[model samples]
Target: MSEIGIRTSGLSPYVALPAELESLENLGISEYQRAAKITDRMRPGIDIPILGLFGEVGSLLAALKKQTRDHPDREKYAASIKEELGDTLWYLANIASRTDQDLDVLAQRTVRSISDWDEVQPNFGTFDDIQSNIKELTQSEFEAILITLAGRVGDLVKDLGSGALTNNRDRLSGHLVDIFGNLLTAADAARISLGEAATANLLKVFSRWPLTEEYPPLIDDGMPDNEQIPRKFEILIEERKINGKIYVQQKLNGVIIGDRLTDNKREKDDFRFHDVFHMSYAVFLGWSPVLRNLLHLKRKSDPIIDENEDGARALLIEEGVSTFIFQRAIDRDFFKGQTQVDYDLLKSIRDFTRGFEVDRCALWQWEKAILEACRIFSELKRYRKGYIAADLISHTLEFRRVPEDRRED
Candidate 1:
């Protein structure tokens, strides 16, 4: 291991190398070497770190695209992001190794730079202070905060140059801190501790499709097993009706609301309205025989050749639309009273939203902005053509499964 080649005794001086980077340096693997090992081929003078970094970034983006486009489980989606980030870190570490840099030193410099920036820009406080203040924000203020946070994430994605990855670790770290700072702030405001929120998210995941949740579980021949194959689009469509009913009922029971809104008439009315949205979505999906049995869906014995058009993603989008409408209703005092359940569910959904790359927050304003575009997209489609786009907007807004399919693995 080489010395960091920097002063370590002065006040706020550069620190030694991080343990992981030291280990990487010990392995004597350079960026070009690792690139060759992974690719088994290389172009001359190609920036391996840049290539690897962008590739990983693309992987993260693709996973997000699939999540929105295909509507897989939230935890699975989160895990995909985590996987890509880890890969990105590998490339980052390789870049450092090739350049004989120290991550600890880079990190300290980043903190110092941020501290200086904070002094200059008094409005943006320290990260911890920002988190503490998130809960104190008014609805409108929180909405603005979410928008700013989103813009920062976009900036980070765009600024990921290969040179930046190797020589500008401090700058990259600053972007990461900003992103995570906003996420943690939102999590704090949502009232659930990170641990609790994570647990809740996991519970939601395991409760849904526990068996085939991870990468659809490939078979020995690399093809999905006949029994373990993903559910058909038609089946999922029917399942949504039962699932939607179950969810609305559960939501009614779970939340502590005023007597005015809890009346049978009100509850029934709300559920019916929610059902209309689903029915409208079904209409948008071209009204096949599968969707025609909207009110009463029965089990089919036939092995239908599923189009696998990624309806789960559409289901998520529809739920976002419903949530957006419901939140607006809440603003209009539709809910006579309430407790924590409303906010908890809202935060979970917001954090779980794909393509946006954000965490839990009180305001749905961020989602509302994106949802408007989705609404426009939905309007452009002619019935059946809308299914794919709608799936990206919704999936996992409800829970539905037949008795035989509900067994634990």
Candidate 2:
């Protein structure tokens, strides 16, 4: 059958070849021979501690880092890094495959053994215990172990401290796989004991905590009668005030929307102005407390907002606008659809304002709204440059038109 026409019946369409076939075919005999030759070239200097390993692996790490950092051309650097990584992996696989081993099987076995070991031994207990274990391994045994590990899994370890230790990808890969394999096993056992202590403490707190009335009033006694209190405080006192006095002043503060004023219609205007002003004060005063409580609650509750909103919103808006423009350009065949936004670029916008504020949820909400607006504008193609410009001008005019009394409130 022709290669294009050949199709197996009753087999998974996706399962054409074993997943390992690519690695095997790519490296195969010729690549293995090349690696063996390289290994032999470095063998003469094997007795020299740093020279043997450094020449073989350290140079590769340094070159990779430099290619990644020094190049202004991102595409070039990315391609170089990818190619180097492939070469490194090919070399590793060749070493393993020729040495009568399967890298995947080795990885699985090592991980399982480490997991079991950790379960049986429990804790390392102290730093001294860890040191003693490290000291116990013989030099030849350590070298053999590292070599075996590197041949199976060297890509996991990160380089550290001036290319002395982790620069040897071959050796580091082996040592890391071994160390982590064992470490994970130990962690599993340790977590069980640690988890018990944590649960007990949580239960103790839950049992002793008191329940209180909801929507309690804020005390107005704290405010001076003649002195003009901030709008936020005033709103908080009005909204949270129960009976003749404020009972829940601290809980009521929030942000003021100075732009959201009512039309001058005596009763409606007075009510709207007072309500918004009081709410704003309440929101401001309660801001920190609410944020603090939200954080505490978040530890036990599901985190709805994971990052800051304002910055994220701006980034999202920027991204949406950029994406819209790019798509339009593409549709118009401006750049022949060559320009593409990468996954990283999109994620960068999404996570732009992470860790900026305490109430990440609030920020996320605002950002989400901005992103939505951008998406709508992009899809509709109604709000192009002209619309954006006009909106900005109108917003400015509206702000400037606000009366001084309303602005003060």
Candidate 3:
């Protein structure tokens, strides 16, 4: 229970949180203010919406600070803060409407995101409750969800480029800004004030990877290709029959690490995905699980790559990051005859990323990783102008040497 009449569940703070949704709707701005011609003096359509959205955010923060610190009356301060928040929502709703974006989509996506932590949600109430639920919410799960979200964001960008919604116009920003309403509701459901979430994220980053006087390059400008990836890993195709139906999967070094299928040795295109991307990405982020759990399904034991419940999470994230490269290859018609295994991976990633409410502390890290990943992809595009695809993958994976020090195992 929160002071704002918002209710949270063990499943997620935002999952179907009606009170938060209703509160956001109630925070409507006056039609008179929306029609004001003051912004018409400037950039008109572009400047007004953008400024209105951010300006209201600023105002909301200011009011919150005053309410928490300067105001003497607690009840009055709470009421004032709620009104300020409503003002912010009014601007966000206007932004969504201007861009023809769907608030329902936004709400659903936000709800799903936070729900990823459903396993831990039932065990605790506050952020401090996280410490006790650390085992259930391990680093593997965190990394998995992070990768999945990153991939979804990438796919969204690709869609935007393909003129899926707003075309190639600046309305793209408007579409992106539409998620703010759901995000606010998510914050409420997660039991953390938006201000606290932002501040905590900032402090977490500053405490760990502090800013340096001279920042390092995105990818190290190094010497030789021989040192890029230290060793090679095998990608083996295996087949199994489940209830009279045969299914194929991709295995890395004898382990059924992925769910992709490669038909036969003659199918050269089946080997399109480079294990280097998945392996190096996991190791670099220290999301690799220490123990491999073998589950008994029938006669032969099946190796579950996901170390625990959370390891399944890391796998999903890995798939998202890996999917961008794979999807790009397919889009470019690089692999003409590859066996179609799981086309729904992107859809899954998108559905989850959109619905999942980001964690209070990890949100900042996820954003940083996503931006850096975009830059990496851009660099890869420039370097692979004429080179072989393998070289491109190798060079890209070279950016982060496997962080052996951080490896859980």
Candidate 4:
């Protein structure tokens, strides 16, 4: 590719630094581009990265709108902005990688857009060196600036498909520099660091979905068998009708565990079957206070563990999470035909579980838990009853046919 961006290499005397301080320092653009590589795509194409760029921009705007409207606490809005903008930056870097372009150099070109014909050489060498150039401003002043940047990015996306810039790498690269310049201005105004966003986005994305499919580690590792989630077990989940009202119940070896459940509403939404979600949480995340309570596995050997991790508060939190997600799932057809869960949904889950042991679980594990739970719940609803075979060790949940002899009439 043609080197159409910017540089100040020979003009600056630079001091190299140690590699171990990577996370603490401003992340380098080239480093982000490399780390932001998307190897987990369902299909390989430029369209994915480009479209992701536009989509993240939209999400950032939506987040800012919420921050502007509901007036959540500063910390909450700060986190929301960081996550949304971080995702936008990830897509930007990934697009550069896919298109054989240099994001850092594009940034450098925008580093000094005016009077560049003769007035060359800035005080900075790398993207991290120019953090001082960023001038902090209030959100009121720069929200419009970011919207403008969004429009510019949207134009670039439009061109990508319209043959105006599809085959022109240099022209597209120049447009990237223009957008980057505006992005820097907006980041400064919003008091956000692109580098910081880059780092945060990495954590969010990889946590949301795995780099590869593998069984994640569970929570209850060394507890006694009685206190621990069973490594593998099956529970018969059935919909039983009594008094012309339907209820969902679980039985293990002809022994009932938890109380029978119903939608507990004027209208039924199959939320009675939400017990499947709690079970999936136990099996996949190894963190479910409701299941612990039901199975008499409250980790009571230690008062602290019992009171905090397996207590009523934890149980309520888990139930609230399941219920909230259930409401969202109702509109989403219980996430039917979805291979991936939304980033914000997973983020909200993490936020709700903050300060809890299960919060330590990765987002991908949560995604798997939700998807698997929904899958089994849909099936159980269709068949009316089935055995939920749960394996904690391998982190698997399967809906199996009830044996003929064991089937309840």
Candidate 5:
């Protein structure tokens, strides 16, 4: 990754973790402060984490906004809130660490501000009494607590802007204590678990970017070669204008596979070639139900694995996630020159793929797949025809221009 350059905090930034991993049931503030220290060691100061707090708080409020004012997808909304609260908590802990403040004490002195805040409180108790206790709150009650959270975040922002935070060590510490308290208040309003939030956040943050890089363990180690996504493969993806409409087709070895594809919209957006994204999933994540189906690589020898992991249902989910991210990328000019996908986009993709085999893959793996695919997708768009190759063992993708003689369809 260092060769081509992997994403970092500045750019937006791997690991294989156990399925039932990351339990922080009795996680203490001090311990959490340490765990949240995944920032780039090169950039020291309270700035990055403090700015991250602002963005996370905004996302938390946006989730609440959608839940309250829009037709919320209840499950997605809930996952989003859990993730946002956890992120808010991490930045708060990160702030504490950078400022040399005590999250333990900040948590203890949390003023207990909201009326029903106790009911919505997170799992992290006072440093001496780490525990999880929560009761649901009415929409109005959640609103009140979250509104208070906004104010506290505003105070922290003021501290950051005032320059007092950088110049006065004592003042920064005070601001951190207050911010940590409101972090609990935000968790309460969301009725999220702090221990769970912190743990989940650690899973996500550590997984998405690298402090120490760890490539994912392949999912097809013992599977039959024909049933497994090939360790190395190349496919010819070519575009042609037939009947005044552009279409894309793919070929492996000497045989064609799958029907030719188009954007299938009133507008031609080059989505016809989106299968490039799937090829990417196969290479980086070691999971793509669509590719399994297309290449006849489904694990039929294990009927249950075939039925569940490589079934129609999983294929649809993968397709849906591709479309979802494609639309998001469209908005940003397809992430032109960008190295990473944003947190919310990754979060939503994570929620969408929650039950599938791909769920085992980490966020960074997903980001890598998406970014690499988009890179090739961009190249494919520019040249109109290319040979996209992959070496699955190395988990790398390459796009090579087709020879001029071969470019003619």
Candidate 6:
């Protein structure tokens, strides 16, 4: 009923579409027109702000201003001036766009040339190595080195918010030149020697290095483990009969003790043996008969009671039945006053219960893993109590549901 492949019946020359040509025509006319329109609209709005800024600047120059000389409020005015300048530039961009001119390309050509000047001029001690070779070079040479570096730095600062150099042409040029200048100056100083060609080679080698890679090691050995390891404690809540009355007594026991080790050999040994120290306890609550038959708790039928029937009897029975069991670990040593614990662990417990009403196995697994990695034996003991409580709360809340009668009421 239908043709199923490329028809190729009306293929034509690859000329620009009529609509595109019309847009280009419109762009040319709009650029100049819009530039004037935008300027007229913005001038009145900016006049008062510009006047206020000038007044402030003049007062600062004369040292007659009440505000602190380098007060942060000056930065606000600077930001405002930049914003106004940006608004003016936006109109200029529209004008350029309408005239079929690419502003970004033009800007790059201009900036790249200026950056060339920045590379050759030198000023002293502007780069990090200036202090080491201060004696070898004259003041003029040092100043020249610094001036070159400063120009390159300015180019970098300009490139920060400029989207025109997406290909990083300006950045690469600026860096190469800056490093070359630094290398030449350093070599002349005799404090640290690196030729211009060698420095260029180094730059080329490092140019492709991923910026997101982990920072180079600051110290020779390794960073010390500063994180406080939590103690693990298994909290067991046992149902018992005392004085002919059924009651639950919650007991906290240290399952895995945590400790901090400075020795690298001991640290590795502790890390390997930490998993074997954990303890687990089953926390029991009331049994449900419906759960035995259904393999889960089922909705109970509501008994329809007459208005005259005892309301207190139903209320007492409902109140006496335990609907939920809660367990939490006392991971912090309150006696020792070590109180910091994983905030996400606590938040996950609350969020998991509130959102899905399911046992937060992911959270428990995370806590267990953390306890396993802990080095402090004492901190590990405290985490066991916390783990037990977290486990009980997560499990008991998962399948717990409200009665339909209660929902209707």
Task: Identify the leading candidate in terms of lDDT.
Answer: 5
* Cα displacement (Å) at residue 9, model 4: 36
C-alpha TM-scores of all predictions:
0.25, 0.21, 0.26, 0.83, 0.80, 0.19
Per-residue lDDT for 64 in model 5? Answer: 89
lDDT of all predictions, in order shown? Answer: 0.36, 0.29, 0.35, 0.74, 0.75, 0.28
Q: Give the poorly placed runs of model 1, Cα more than 4 Å off.
A: 1-46, 114-409
Question: In model 2, which range of ten residues has the least summed lDDT?
Answer: 390-399
Better of 1 and 4 by TM-score: 4
Candidate 6 or 3, higher lDDT: 3
Best by TM-score: 4
Off by over 4 Å in 4: 1-26, 39-48, 112-127, 133-135, 138-140, 214-216, 242-245, 403-409
- Provide C-alpha RMSD values for all models, in order: 20.1, 22.7, 20.7, 7.8, 6.5, 26.1
lDDT score of residue 275 within candidate 3: 42
lDDT string for model 6 (55-155, tens) is 32233222212222444464443333333223323333333343334433332333246545434322122212322445656535644653453454345
Weakest 10 consecutive residues of candidate 1 by summed lDDT: 212-221
The global Cα lDDT (0 to 1) of model 6 is 0.28
Weakest ten-residue segment in model 4 by summed lDDT: 1-10
Candidate 3: Cα lDDT at 37: 20
User: For model 1, how does the per-residue alpha-carbon lDDT over 102-213 read when each residue is reduced to its tens digit?
Assistant: 3323322333554464332312222223224334655456445445545655566566543454457566666655544544544444332333332232223222212221
In model 6, state the lDDT of residue 167. Answer: 57
Model 3 quality (TM-score): 0.26
Of 1 and 6, the candidate ahead on lDDT is: 1
User: Can you write out model 4's per-residue Cα lDDT over 160-196, one digit (the tens) per residue?
Assistant: 8887776788777877777777777766667776677
For 1-409, candidate 5 gives per-residue lDDT tens digits of 1212222221122343332334344656666676666443426777777788888888888888988888587776777788888878877777777766656656755554546324333334433253334577788888887777777777878877877666687666666656666666656556566667776676676777655446655777788878988888899999877888678889988578798998989877899889999999988888889988889899988998889889999999999999998888888887888888898798788778876767767788888888888888999889888898988888899998999876534
